[model samples]
Target: MRVVVVGGGIAGVSAAWAFAAEPDGRPRGGVSVTLVEAEATLAHHTTGRSAAQLIENYGAQALRPLTTTSLPFFHEPPEGLTDAPLLTERALLTVGTVEQDEAIERTLAEGRLANPTITEIDGDEARRRAPLLAPTDGHRYVLEPESADIDVAGLHQAFVRGFRAAGGTIATVTRLDAARANGSGWRVETTTGPIDADIVVNAAGAWGDVVATAAGVEPVGLTPLRRTAFMVRSPWDHESAGWPLVADAEHTWYLKPDGAQFLCSPADETPSAPMDAKPEELDVAIAIERINSHTTLDIRTVASSWAGLRTFSPDRSMVLGPDPDHPGFVWCVGQGGTGIQTAPGAARCCASMALGEPLDERIDPGGLTVDRFR
Candidate 1:
């Protein structure tokens, strides 16, 4: 079978790799895979502009298993896929003020259910973990010690390497124009030309619905939400390196240490179109204000900033597997903000469902499949 995966982001590459190779990284017979990217490069959008951290307690309950299933791959990736490890030790710290005590407790309960390592700590301990946090009274904090910083580029490259090694083809600068059913397969029209495929996987990120519409499939109500992030110089220098990723319990703002700088975001989720996202000055200013009010960093200037779209299904869960009506049209979009951390298991599940194979025991997608939306 010839499988054509649209989009070259982490989701697309991982899905293509899974379709072409076995879990142990050996090439799979009787199947061919091709990955097509709209831009000249892969991961030019959301995948490239991510605040790359893996927090197991994040995302919806139905989607958390995907993160859990991906842990093994991050810890010990396929031998020849990458030279360095894809994950580095880091932790997540979520804080709330006295007024948000209920919110903190709710979050803590939910977090503990997903990851037992998640624990609540006092304000003083929170400040010790993230020294920049202000010494506010009645502050509540939850810590996820198993969280880590992901090597976003390295992980993407690993999938690319595995796909290539399995004899998969990748076509950069090739955008899918449309697709139509042809007998038992599909005639995929692209910017460069046309190709025939037995299956067409829609992993177009923010353009998921657009791709589906172009293929004459019913839209799945995917909303692309914009998230702004910027970098500021870290005042503590090396001391900030050990600090955990700190965020407001309500997710109004977040800060992560990166080398000599700190990556900060407003955690804004404004509706957006499927296009190249740009950071808004107002959003950055809001982030600075919130970060300053909550921490001692008092951010004054932004070294750099960018935005990315985190598309989501109406239910806020991923839309994976083959569409109910269009069995050959696979859906690998609507990752929301968990795409990077869940790529491995999500890709494997997508491929398994697409090829009529059983899912891995560890991955429990629950109600987050394509049929759920249908």
Candidate 2:
């Protein structure tokens, strides 16, 4: 069977790796995989622009299972697949003001449900974990020690190496024009050439619905929200590598230590059409103001900034299986904010439905499958 996976982002690469490998890292029988990317290089879009975090309690409730399942892969990747560790120990600190008491409760409840080890902490401890929060008023914090900082590039490359080593073909500068049924299989037209495949995986990020529509399949409602992030010089007088990822309990903004600097975001979720997203000046300015008001850092200049689209379904959960209406058309999109953290389990699920493998024991194929949209 020939499997064509669209998009070369983290989700697409993860799915391709599964199709290209046996559980033991050998080439799977009879299944040939091809990963096609529209850009000149892989992960030039949302995948490359991610904040690169591995917070287990993040995203929709149904999606938390995937995060837990992906931990092992991030912790101990396949032998010789990655030269360095994909994850590093870093805490997730969520703080709230007295006015946001309900938001704090909701965060704690959701976080504890996913990771029972999460603990509520007083303002002093919050400030201790991140000294920048020292003077912030009306703030309290909850700590999820299990969360960590992920090496985004390293993790993405591991899958790429695995896929290539398994004899999978990667086609860049190949934009999918459309795809349609050819008997029991599909004939996909691209900018470079045509590909005939037994199945096609739609991992097209924000272009998910567009790809579906081109293939004569009904479009799933995937709303892409733009999230802007920027870096500012760490205003701390001393080293801050020991700090945790600090996010507002109201979900308004977040900042984390990065080398000698700090990465911050307004957590903006503006509705957007499918395209290459760019950071708006206003979004950057707003994030700076929020970060300044919440912390001791009086950020004045942005070192760099960028934006990426976080696509979501109507329910804000991922769609990761064969489309109910068209079995040949599989849905592996709608990652929202959980793309990097949940890629492994989501990919395994997509590969099974595409390659006729059994469902992975780690994943709960409950509300995440594409059948929910029907």
lDDT, candidate 2, equals 0.89
Give Cα distance to truth, residue 128, candidate 2, Å: 1.3
Off by over 4 Å in 1: none
Please provide, for model 2 over 1-374, each residue's C-alpha lDDT reduced to its tens digit, 9 standing for 90 to 100.
Answer: 89999999999999999888865567787889999999999999999998888998888888888888788788888776799989988899998888988988998998888889998998888877888984756766889998888888888898999999998999999999999898999999999989999889999999999999989988879999999999888866338976899998888999999988898999999999999999999999999999888888889999999999999999998998887778989889999999999888788878887656787575677778877777
lDDT per residue (tens digit) for residues 145-229 in model 1: 9899999999999999999999999999999999998888899999999999999999999999999999999989999999999
lDDT of 2 at 344: 81
TM-score of 2: 0.97
TM-score of each: 0.98, 0.97
Q: Pick the candidate with the highest TM-score.
A: 1
How many Å off is the CA of 85 in candidate 2? 0.1
Which ten contiguous residues of candidate 1 have the minimum total lDDT?
A: 365-374
lDDT of all the models against the reference?
0.92, 0.89
Candidate 2: residue pairs that collide: none
